[model samples]
Target: MSSTHNQEKLKELLTQYYLNTNEKMVFLNKKGQVIALNEAAEEVFSEDNDYSQMTHAICRRCEGYSNEFDLMSCENCFLEALEVGNGSFQVFMRTKDDKIEPFTASYEVIDKTKEIYAFTLHNVSPQIERQDRRYQRLMMQKTISAQENERKRISRELHDGIVQELINVDVELRLLKYQQDKDELIDNSKRIEGLMSRLIDDVRNLSVELRPSSLDDLGLDAAFRSYFKQFEKNYGMHIVYHTDFSSQRFDSEIETVIYRVVQEAMFNALKYAQVDTVYISLYQGEASIIAEVSDQGIGFKLGDKAKGTGLGLFGMNERAELVNGSVNIDSQVGRGTIVTLEVPITDKR
Candidate 1:
């Protein structure tokens, strides 16, 4: 074949590919006027029937969000930013059938002489929904695992700590019954009393660890203050605690979720961070209650293998989601770690 004929055939092949591709492709001028569009784009904005009539500023079919802002909004409109050469962005747009959807979009200058640009969009709503569903399932599994583990822990505490102590006390009492000397009998009685006291304290501590009654009786602030004091004494770590809610109360579920997440974060810091001091802040935002636990200690890489079971972080996320909340963990090696939990609160009192 002649070179001229081969060139013509190649042009025809390119035209066919452009017209048949599923991706929505459009060519626009510097003025944001639609210069031309492929068959996929034609179907998306079929209301116009004529491509020449479609301009980005007035297109109704593309109503959605770009750069976390409504696409129609004048501020940070991705189309407008094309004149200044911006990067690819995620966009959610209403389809021709009126269903809102997500798309990954890219725009680039195609003809500098004419100030023309090519805009491409790839539909990603299905992939996003699938990922979200998978995440929710994983979270549910983690939550169930955490509950089971906690039950096992409480069972162990009752069986090993309290029950064993009671058995020892029983043996001591049996020895007291056989004692002949009054002084020895008195010493045995004192030993049994001390054992009983220690057992009582252990049971109380176990109960608190399972679920602190103060959480339900006095609200989150009181529970946190009491817990922090005990934590400091146990770990010899100094905690700087601050809170804005004096006596303000929230839905029980929200309060519990926030308190538990913060508590878990604090424990993680103490176990891993090697820091002597930690900071905890609790406050109410406009629509959410926020708890932040931070430490200026040795932090680990965010995605590296965990030193511990790693369920603490997962449980925090699961609990936060139960209350329509979120947990964010930020850490860098040798810098620090900050765990923040934000839960939406509907103030009941």
Candidate 2:
């Protein structure tokens, strides 16, 4: 059969199947115009019988979106599929009754010659709920994994660089106390003393990983600069940093969340992007603070399973949401990865 014929047959079959649905069903045109809906769908998206007035009401209520950016509707809007003429997706939606529900939706071009398209949403509340639970569990695991990785990194840095250097310094100082050929050995001892002092400073700097005093004492800008310096020094990755936030101290939780997210994103960039350079931008808007990290290197597939624990992205997202913020990652194979996080901020008054 012709593709056109097949589509019509499929639509009819879908309509018949959907008529028996206990959940909501909605159909939209390419312009987000509500064309058809089952009884459940009508009641969910509209309060009255005038379904035409509903338009993309359901799309507007979708919960998943890139908080880092301003979006008119959920990123999962069926119109996104309509744009391409053959994409389908599902997402959580908040109904007109203020109840959250899930729907399985698809959009396809019905008549390419006439530019007519159809978007269908089948009530998939059960499936969506199940998937959401799975997502949460995955996120929790990610957070735990990230914490462990951090501990290991700090431990190694201290053991290899700081602790070992201190040991050598201690031995040198002991020799200085024992062997003094008076004026002859004084300069050599002084030079060793200078090296030991610098080593002490380095160890002190390494301790910043445990808890950056700069975050509380100097605020985010200073803290980030210090952290980025250490990131470059230790990981050998260069970061292009930019900031435009008002020099105001945030709640401790917000500060820590932002710091950790940036830290994670940079690490991911270094590991996956294979690029030597990372870009970071921080700016505050009227109601939200935004952080963006981008890297130009070998990009991996989005939604693809991460080779390791896959907790890095998950942890970053959880931290963002902890502060009522949202995280978005945009990446494509061979293009690069961009992570943007936004958190709501209130005036201290």
Candidate 3:
């Protein structure tokens, strides 16, 4: 066929494909004015009865600009970048249903002599929602795993520590009954008394580990002070602590959740940060309580694969959520890490 006839045939084929495709497509001029749109684009604007009168209308459906520029401004728009052949980027736009949704957009100069550009959009909201659901399910599983591990630890402590001590005392008492000399019997009785004292200490330690009695009796402030002191003594790590809500009290559930999250954050720093000193601060907001723990030690990337099982961070988040709270973690690879927990003072139950 002749060159003119071949060009006409190619245009017809392109027009047929554009009309039959499901994706939204439109043509615009260099000044960002709409020239023409395909049937899929027409249906989207039809929901608002805007298709017939949309000639040369500036596309205001953009929800926000990309992160590289002002979030909601039109400056440096993708259309402007078409002069340099910038082809594709992601954007959020307001749909006919009045919802701001994400779309993968592609822009290209279809007519170089006239400076006309073609823009195509593909909806991506369903894929984003599916990923969020998967993350939430994984977090729930991690929380359950952490609880089970804690239960096993407590059980092992009782069986191996206290129960074995009791057996030793029983044997010592039986030996006392078989002693012939009075002096020998007295020595055996003294040894039994020593074992009983050690057994009592073990029980108290276990009770504190499960749930400190001071937390219920004195409140969060007093409990934290005592816990921090013990932590320093045990691990030889110093914690610079400060608090403004010294005598204030909150709902029991809120107090417990905050305490547990802070405890876990501190443990994570001790195990991974490898720092000698840490800082902790607590204060009350208008309707919430905020606690922060930070350490100047080795940190890790936000989305990088974790070195450990990572259940500690998951457990901290789960505990906070139990009381209508949130946990925020910030870290840099060579800098440090900070964990903040905020819980509303309202009744969560």
Candidate 4:
């Protein structure tokens, strides 16, 4: 073939394939009525379409835009508000399946003389679903990591702290068997008895740290009281606590998740906030349970390098999410840090 013929053939193929892809291209008049559309749009929207539906001045399948007030609302509708050429947003639209899904939409006046525009859509719901899946995987991985780390710490504590003391007591008891002095034997026996009491206390403390008995038997209100006393004694720091909550019980899952998140928040403050005192507020809102942990200390900026594993914050957020809740952290360089958690009361049942 001649060179000119080859160029014409290339253009033909380009025209043939360009309009048949996954993208939906729609041409609209000034009235927002669909004037023309590509093969892809036709394939996607043809099943439920009728003659009047096609010709009537209707927004081409657009539902609404997501705003701060609502996820999808006709408030400040895009049809009336799409500017001349600077219109681009995430829009919800009804697809071929008659299901609403999100899409990246762009509107531009392609022909100013006729006041005609081109509206395009690229479905974003698939991408959003993929992102959600990835986040869930990350959450699961981190949860497992946290569990293993806790188990290892507990195992090491048992082997080193209590087990070592027990071994020393065992040696003393065996030596007592060979001792000739009655008073020396009695003294050693009493010493061994003291060691056994301490060992029992250590095991009980470990068990409580793993899962506070008050959390299950009583409620979060009681659990926090017990936890804070131990926290102050163990870390030499005070928690100025206030509560507007009572002893009413919640779903075990909700109570447990909130308890763990609060525990982690306080632990983070103790480890990094560089303060002698922390403030905590627990309350029951109209539809949610809320907790706030605050500290006036040498605060660090967010997105800066974390002093610790950095997974603590993410883990807290993830755990809160599991119970239909949220965790918000606010901090500044020299001011202070506050961690807030909210769980909906709908989950209380």
Most lDDT-accurate candidate: 1
| lDDT tens readout by residue for model 3, 176-234 | 88999999899889999999999998887777767999888888989999888878977
Flag regions of model 2 displaced more than 4 Å.
1-142, 184-188
Give each model's whole-structure lDDT: 0.82, 0.74, 0.81, 0.81
* Residues 1-349, model 4: lDDT tens digits: 8999999999999677657667877777876667777777764456347522454333556677765445665666666666623756787777677788887777787799998877777788879999999988887887788789989999999999989988988898888889889998888889989999988878878888989999999999999998898889889999999998777889999999888888988999888889999999999888899999999988887778877667899878878999889888899877889999999976454
Tell me the tens digit of each residue's lDDT in model 1 across 1-349. 9999999999999899788888888887877677778878755655365655546622455564456423545566656666423666776667677787778878889889999888787788789999999988887786788789889988888889899999999999888889999999999999999999999888777777779899899889899888888778778989999988868888899988988898899889989999999999999989999999999999989779877667788789889999889899999999999999998878665
Give the number of the best model, judged by TM-score.
Answer: 1
Candidate 1, backbone clash total: 0
Report the C-alpha displacement of residue 321, candidate 4, in angstroms: 2.7
User: By lDDT, is 2 or 4 better?
Assistant: 4
**Can you write out model 2's per-residue Cα lDDT over 1-349, one digit (the tens) per residue?**
8999999999999778788766565655545566766766664666464656656554566774222234325444445634533444555567777886655655577666755555455567677678889988877776777778878988887788778877877877777777758875686677777777877777767667667999988788899998898888878899899998646888888888998898888878887788999999999888888999999889888768886787777678778888888899899888898999998985442
The C-alpha TM-scores of every prediction are: 0.82, 0.63, 0.73, 0.80
RMSD each, Å: 3.6, 7.1, 4.7, 4.5
* Steric clashes per prediction: 0, 0, 0, 0
Model 4 spans > 4 angstroms off:
1-18, 47-72, 75-89, 111-115, 124-138, 179-183, 300-309, 347-349
CA lDDT, candidate 2, residue 191: 73
